[model samples]
Target: MSLPLIGTLKLRGRLTLYVTLLAVAPLIISTWVGANTTRQMMQDQVHEMLRIEAEGLKDLVEASLVERETSVRSWAEDSLVREALLTGSYEQSDAVLSRLQLRYTTFTGLVLFTESGRAVSASTPALRDSFLGQDEAVRNAPWFKAAQEGHFTSATLTQEDPVFGMQVLHLAAPVMESRGGRRLGVLLAAYDWGQVGEVVKAALERARSRKNESFALEVRTASGTLLFDSRGQDAWHVPNAVAAEAINGPEIADVGDGWRFVALSDPEEVYATVNKLRAGTLVGVLAVVVLAALAAFLLARGITLPIARLNRVVRRIVQEGDLTQKLEVRSKDEVGELAESFIQMVDNLRETTESLQRGTRVLTETVAELTRAAEQQESNITRQAAALQQTQVTAQEIKQTSMVAAERAGAVLQVASRAEELGRGGALALTESMSGIQTLRDQVDEMADQIGRLNERAQRIGGITQTVKGLADRSNMLALNAAIEAVRSGEHGKGFAIVAKEIRTLANQSIQSTAQVGDLLEDITQAILKTVELSEQGQVRMEAGLAQARTSGDSMRALSTIVQDNMNAVRQIANAVSQQNAGIAEIFNAMTDLSTMMHDTMVGLQASQRVTEALREVATQMQQVARSYRV
Candidate 1:
């Protein structure tokens, strides 16, 4: 949808809008999409890394529990512990328990309890004072039931212990008979929960600082009791409401029995990076839009300024009727070519106008000179009429001289024969000249055909040049992609990188060569254009010359008629001299009138032909100027 403001904006705004549509919008969309994709990918990678670390921590905790279970089972089967529990012999059992405690220092305390929850022996003397028989809490404990069921159980319990203050895990193993396999008592070992927490914490720490975000480490029981939280926000080792909220979000790994390693992920730190990327993208997008808008404005200015100048020049010419205005060609681009063409058009028009003016002046002078000569001929004919009247009176007086008249008639007949020979020769010359003109016309047509063929070849060359350019561009793109892949391959792709570089260089050279070929084609096209134009002009001139030659042939036919008329007049003069001298004056007057009329007609025909040729040239030049514009 377009905004209302868009319609109201000028050329600059339109250009800016087009630029944004063409350049900026796609950039923003691609950048945003790429950033989001990267963020999702990175988030998935972080989750995978955290899960792997969690699994490792789970294995460590399980190994710790397994080792404690092994030690407890071995002690539970010992004869000293069984004797202490069954026979109430604490001296030997305590000695053995002390030795066990010394070997595994992580066991804060150890105890031997009977099947009925009575304390048999203790590893620590201080904890022994508090050991109770018939205690409900001890008998009801989950680990106690697990031990009676002949299974090793690790149970996390929070208490204020002297050695390991906040929380401890009790590892229990059941003691049984060697032969009958009867239950005897339970052996218990207190492993500080802090040791297990250190393992979990270490695994998390190794992964936490690597990427994405910071997270809290937590150890919980299957019953949703939070045992150890690295956050240290809950020092009492109590179940936290906030921490429970994250039970669904946190990733969990089972340590053993019911205990779990939970990592409560906090993504704020990781998303902070995504936020920064988004901010930078917005900033860069804004920068690109600003730059694009600025370029659009400058581009609009460049185009409009030239158009305005051209319009002003055209308007001036239209108003003033001046064909002398010319535009300055500032660049070698389309606008410059348009200006150059317009200048040429105006120059051609001016030259044609000047030629017409000169032709008109010469025609006027020719008409004036012809009128004066005709007036002089009319005067000479009037004097010859007066002479004919006197000659008639004199000839009537010479009617008696028949012999002289007959001699003059014989001489007149000889003159008539000579004139007939000259007329026949002139007619043959006219026929030969017409044949030469026809040959010239044929040659002109053949030249036009050859020039047309050259134009076609030029077009073919242009297409070939374009094909080469496309191939070069494609090769360059392929080389660039190859270089990118080589760089991605790092040290292994050094040889390929060298090959790609050479390919790119060759592609560039090919592109340059194609461009040079294209320039040559343009030159050829221009030369062909000029040749065709010259041929057309020559054809036009040849046609005009043919027309003039035909006109001359008609004049020659008329001259032949005049020559026949002169011969008839000479015969009439001889007849008048021989028969009646009275008719001689009339024949002489008729000859003088015919001569004056023919002279005037010849002068008018010559002037008309000259004017026609001049007008034809003007029209041809105007057409050439008009052809320069394509549309």
Candidate 2:
């Protein structure tokens, strides 16, 4: 369906495809933007968590240092240092140093200098050996001099050392008499400043400062002597301008690195603040994104489901060629009307096609009937022609027979005339003979004239018979020519062609029958010849009879004039009887010739009718064959 629709664009709607594309474009754009937003928000959330974690550990380290300092200060006020200094015994001093060293790892050296600036009891063997020696640091150190004033302490810091090496927190206090308040030597306690340095390095890790973001430390005594400081060329600084704000007090500050910044000092406080913002923002964004996604899913489902169903219906109709399928769209919209119209159109087209087929069938039937009738008529004509030809043959035979009879009658009549002449001569001689002779002579004269007329009549009948025979022959020839022409015409002239074949048969029959007529005519000619010979012979016999009649007439005229008159009366009766007999025979022969001609004509017509009838049948058959060619 999709491929065929691409082939024919007319079925496609004007705005349907465009509107779908329009809807899809925005959906795609919205999905992309939403994904990007969610990604940015998640990254922000992760970074904030790392920063807050860094700030949290920073505060814990600071608090640990403060507690350490307070614990160490209170420990120094014990009577252990005064006792150690008063005894100064080798074993006793070592005992106190060892005892105090066991209390803490921050201590490096604890020494007591004399009023003359001499070192006294020490915490370690090496430092004890160096005591009472004039070392500038041991003799002129801030702690050494500060002990003259009593109870002055230095902050924990990085500082140089002479007796036991570098130190951190150094505190000094004057020892007074138990009874009168007299001062013993000053008590000096040196702390390892490296311990404080460890605190600062620890702070850097806890603060989450980069390896390049460094830290610095410094300390000053009350007399203005610099006591401890964490300053070295190798030190990695806690580098930041925002650290200046932290320097004012113990509070959090924003430290600016070139690319970014962070607040520290209150490690937990910064963590709590930034993390609160991060968790809230993440949850809010998540809620919004989830809501949006759910709404989009629901919306897409709602819109696309209807469209998909519509597409399915369209595909089914197009693919299957089933116009009966209609849209099931519940909405009363344009698409619904379109489906209805399509169904209606298909129904109308089917009905119209059926009606057209019916009309064509009726028209075909009418033409077939008319064609059959024409062929039947032609067949009838051919049959009639055959019959007509038979009749013509009969007529020709009759005409020839009549001619022979007429010829014989005429010869008899001529012989009768000669007898009449001989009869008049016979009447002069004998009376009895003369009476018969006169009758014979009168009959001969009348017979002679009648015979002459009969001969003429025979000739006429013969001429008429020949003419009718010629006409019949011509008609037969014409029928044969027509048949030959039809055979030459091939299948196209098959109707006429069969008619021609029938005509040929009719012609052949007519020809044969005519030949029979010719044979009968030949027989009639022989009979005529026989009649002429017979008539001549009859003439001779009649002549002999006429002479006898003449002698008799002579006798009658001589012997009795009255008898001669009676003989004259007998002659008149003989003349009338002989003449009537000859004339009647001639008329009968003429009638016979006419009957033969008529029969021949009838036969010719019948033959033609037979041929024509056969032709009509052939025409009807041809029409039927032609009808077979139609679908």
Candidate 3:
């Protein structure tokens, strides 16, 4: 029922099932439809035939009733029957009625009644004796009353005399006079109801003989009272029976007083041919299903067999890892094309595998060469790293030596600076000494001029001393006169005389000291002359010393200039050495870095060699894999 479960079935089985269903489904449906249609048609036909038989039985019963009625009416119109009624005699009418009952066996009995309702004649002795004196009973009868009223009448179903004990129908007609057509007496006939049963039985017998089908017949009155049944009591009550009816009034008039005739037949017997057809259709459907299954199985095998073979070849190629396998093409259908394409693919794969084998060999050789080259490069890089390390160490020593030389040059520069400062100080001192010597020379020249002026002033002072000596002599003369005057005055002149004597003594001492001063002035003049000569000589020497001191200052300044130049040169040498030391340090650091880089390069080369060796191993593995294939 599930599609997955159906898919797991073999192709032939699935195809067979589908084809069988396709073939048999319509056959079964048509068989069922045809069987039901046939059954309905057969049932209708059986009912139609029964209806025809019922109609025929109805006609027979009508004819019998009409014949009985005609006979009774004719007998009522007979001249002998009118004479017997007119004369009130019985012999002749009795013989006529007797002959009539003998002529028609359907009639059970015949009787005649007079105008006053007296039974006069009868067809048999029992019929005559039973109704001969029953004038009131006869006159009160419905059929007898209707005959007296000049109408022919038939009575409802009733039983005959106890001697016969059978169902019958009553018919009556009025006797009329010849000239006036006056109603005289009544003639009544008891027709046997067994005649209707005989008609139905005969019809049933004919149907059974012709068609060999079982049938039943029933006769009933207008109110459905059962009169006759050919199937006997309660035997015609079949539930599935096909039945048809013929009523009395529509086909035949006044037969059995508006009775019904019916015919029945069984349905199972009616549809027998249709049942056989259904059985035969089922057999045919089964045969068609079997044939369809066989054809589908053959078709499925034709389609799947070639595909199965292709699958087997694919599996073998995969398991064996053989690209050299080929396929055989047998047909020009799509399956054959698939096989051809598979063969082409296999050939292409074989070629590709062979190409891979050759490529792996070349790759292996290349990897081996690369590995050898990497190893040699690694060794070379190792030696280069050592050389770089040694160069870095030498550069470091050079940097240290340059630093020491720069420090020494700085010391020399500082010493030269100190010496330059000393020389400058010496030059300044010499310049100051030269200025002092020049100042001394100027003062010496001034001193010599002052000495010459002093000598001239001393000569003027000698002339003054001669004049003072003359004044002293004059004063001594004056003093002697004053002494003489005093001696002439006696008392006043004594004091005056003492004063003159003292004055005279003082003048004499003045004269003596003046002479000594003259001699000293001459000596001072001579000494002034000598001092001027020395001052002139000293000025000359001082000028010479100032010139010499100026020369020494110039020499000292020149020496200071030379020392300052030397110190500048020393400073430049120290700076150059300091810069050189820095440059050497930089070179040392660069060499150290170069050495480290070379070491790293060597390590990289060794790693590359290992990678190359790994690549060679991979190539060898590839060669092994390629060799496994046959191609």
Identify the candidate with maximal lDDT: 3
Model 1 superposed RMSD (Cα):
46.7
How far residue 631's Cα lies from its native spot in candidate 2, in Å, is: 58
lDDT (Cα, tens digit) per residue for candidate 1, span 115-214: 7887768887766667654456667887788788767454536554443355667777887877788888888888777776567666556656665235
lDDT of 2 at 171: 61
The clash count for each model shown is 0, 76, 0
Better of 1 and 2 by lDDT: 1
Candidate 1 Cα deviation (angstroms), residue 223: 5.1
* Stretches of candidate 1 exceeding 4 Å from the true structure: 152-165, 204-213, 234-259, 271-278, 306-631
Model 3's lDDT to the true fold?
0.80
Please report the candidate that would top TM-score against the real structure.
3
lDDT of 1: 0.72
Q: Please give the TM-score that candidate 3 achieves against the real structure.
A: 0.46
lDDT of 2 by residue, 244-363 (tens): 112212353211111111232323333344456556665766565555555555655555555566667657645654445555555455555555665576566445545545655665
Each candidate: what lDDT?
Answer: 0.72, 0.54, 0.80
